[model samples]
Target: MPQAQQLDPDTFAVRHRIVLVTAWLQVPFLVAVALLTTGLGQAELGTIGAVAVVALGATVTQSIRARAVLASVALFAASAVLIYLSGGTIEAHLHIFAMLPFVALYQDWRPLVASVGFVVVHHVGVSVLDPEGAFNHHAAQHKPLLWALIHAGAVLVTVVGLLALWKVLEDASRATVAALEQVEAERRRRLEDAERFGAELAREAARLVDVSGRVGEVAGVVRETQEASSQRVGELSRRAVDASRAGEETRERVGSGVATMGDLEQRSGEVESLIVLISEIAERTKLLALNATIEASRAGEAGRGFAVVADEVRNLAAQSADAVDRIRETLVAIRQGTTTTAEVLDQVEAAVDGIQTVQAEVVAVAGEEAAAGEVLAAQVHELTTLAGSLSGAAGTMSELAASGR
Candidate 1:
């Protein structure tokens, strides 16, 4: 059994009022028809007036059951008046069926049942009381019970089919609502998942961007350090080259000093030889003076002066030989000092050579360091570029995440 409570109440309310109010349209049409065909009289006015009262009563009633029952009575009553006013025309009879859809639109079988029941009663009452208003044909007029039963049977059949269809439509509507709710649930879930994933992606992107920024900053610092290192290496290389050059100059000066010392040593040896020859000559002279003194002593008193002169000459030669001996010792000491100075100059030359070699090695190592610094700086620059790219990618991801949220 269908009750007045609708599956969709809001829609039912609007349609319910429309059904009730629009049922009045038939009243005026029926009245006009009555005026034209049967001519307006007391019965027509009385029927139409009663239907208006019933419809108004339905509007005022709070109980859905009473309202539905009253609306149904009004519809059938109006149809009856329309049938009578049309002189029981076939067109006028269609109003009864036409009113059924409005009742069905409310999705309530109460109005349908009530309308069917009212029609059956009205037909039974009318056929017995006044068959002309119900049937225009002779057979329907004569056998009014059969025609009325047939009409009631037809209405019952249509209402049964309509109720079945209404049930089908109602089920379909419920299924549609359920399916829509499920779809909405799925959509909400998907939206939540998207927002969560987007948030995760944004967080990861932010981390990447932050890490990239730090990397870029570190790389930039490293690049600057490497550039400074390269410059320092270059300066060190130049200094090494200058030191090598200075070492070479010092070695050359040392070589010249060593050569000069060797020459001086040779000259000292020659001077010593001359001093030895002079000492030998002085000894021979002393020997000759001693012999002359002995000869003079044999000559007596005249030779006394000659012996004194010979002794004096011997003393002078002895002094000259002593001086030559001291000169020879001094020349030996000079040669010894010259030999030491030559050896010292040689050592100094060797040290300068070692220093030059070390400087050369330093220059080579500095060159290598500069090259390595260049490579390091290039690597740092590449890292900075990589960080910039990461930042750009992160920014794009952040924008995408923002839009998603």
Candidate 2:
């Protein structure tokens, strides 16, 4: 009935040795008790057979139950042989009681029960069948059955007490073992949790490190882009100022051009007036030439030369009127071209103003962005450092968990 698994390794080892040693020692012990009971060899084959049985059961039995049951039963036989050898001495029975504790050491009641049964059978059977060998006194031989019952009762009482003690021991041992196993189970569970948590933390830390690294790279790129943008904004702003300045100069040039245009307009007006006066003089000359031709016709052949001079004067007046008309057409074209050029200059100045406003705003926004970028880069650097620290902690935890496992 003894289960080896119930005992922890340490207790099992110690009890194992004790049981084996005691079982083996029973052989020599029986021999010594027999010699001590009656100093010499009065018996022959019975003692030898009994001793041999003890030896075989002690030595040959493998299992704890086999060893305990066989050895305990054999000890009863050995004690019976000693009793017979001693002529049924009262003290030879003590050997039977002595072996009980040894089997009781197994913490298994079944072996004790087996030992008791063997003792009962041997006492009744031996006393009834061989009273001379089973009893030392003639009084016991006359009523061996009563004597056997008395001896069996004594053994049962001892066995009952031992069984009580065995019950307490069995309960205590099982409780201790159960408690130890529970502790080991909880310990193993805690270790598994620690290993799982450590592994998970390590993996998450790796991901954090990767993400932080990428964040750092992205921050660097953003920093570079911001720097470039800031510089470009500065350049544009400078260009805008230059354009504003250019716009001022253009305004001044436009003012000068307006003044020049006004002078050109006035001069063109004078030329127009002069053309009108010349046209009037040409008409008067044509009329005077016509009147002279009439007078010369009245004077006949002497007036022929005067009439030819009037015709040349009329041709000269017509040619002068045609030249004045061409001059007025050219003046009108110059005035229209001047007005278009002035309008284009005004538009260029307005566009320059708009460029300057947009450039100034861009520069302001770029400056704010640059400052924000610096702050973001600093935070990202901190995050990367923190992630590294977490990774290191997780790595250390993993090492500890692995070692513990």
- Candidate 1 clashes between residue pairs 3 or more apart in a chain or in different chains: none
Q: Write the per-residue lDDT of candidate 2 for residues 289-332, one digit (tens) a residue.
A: 89989988999999999999988888888887788778778878
Off by over 4 Å in 2: 1-20, 30-37, 42-49, 61-67, 81-92, 105-114, 121-147, 166-228, 241-362, 372-405
For model 1, the superposed segments whose C-alpha errors exceed 4 Å read 1-5, 17-21, 40-42, 50-75, 277-327
Residues 1-405, model 1: lDDT tens digits: 333345455675677688788777667876777778878789878988888888888889988767777877788889888887777777877888888777787677677778888889888998999898789999999999999999888788788877887878877877898999999999999889889988988998989898998998899799889978988998888888888888888888888888898888888878877887888889888988989799889988999999999999899899999899888888888888888988898888888888888888888898889878878978997898899889988988888888877
TM-score of each: 0.82, 0.54
TM-score of 2: 0.54
lDDT top scorer: 1
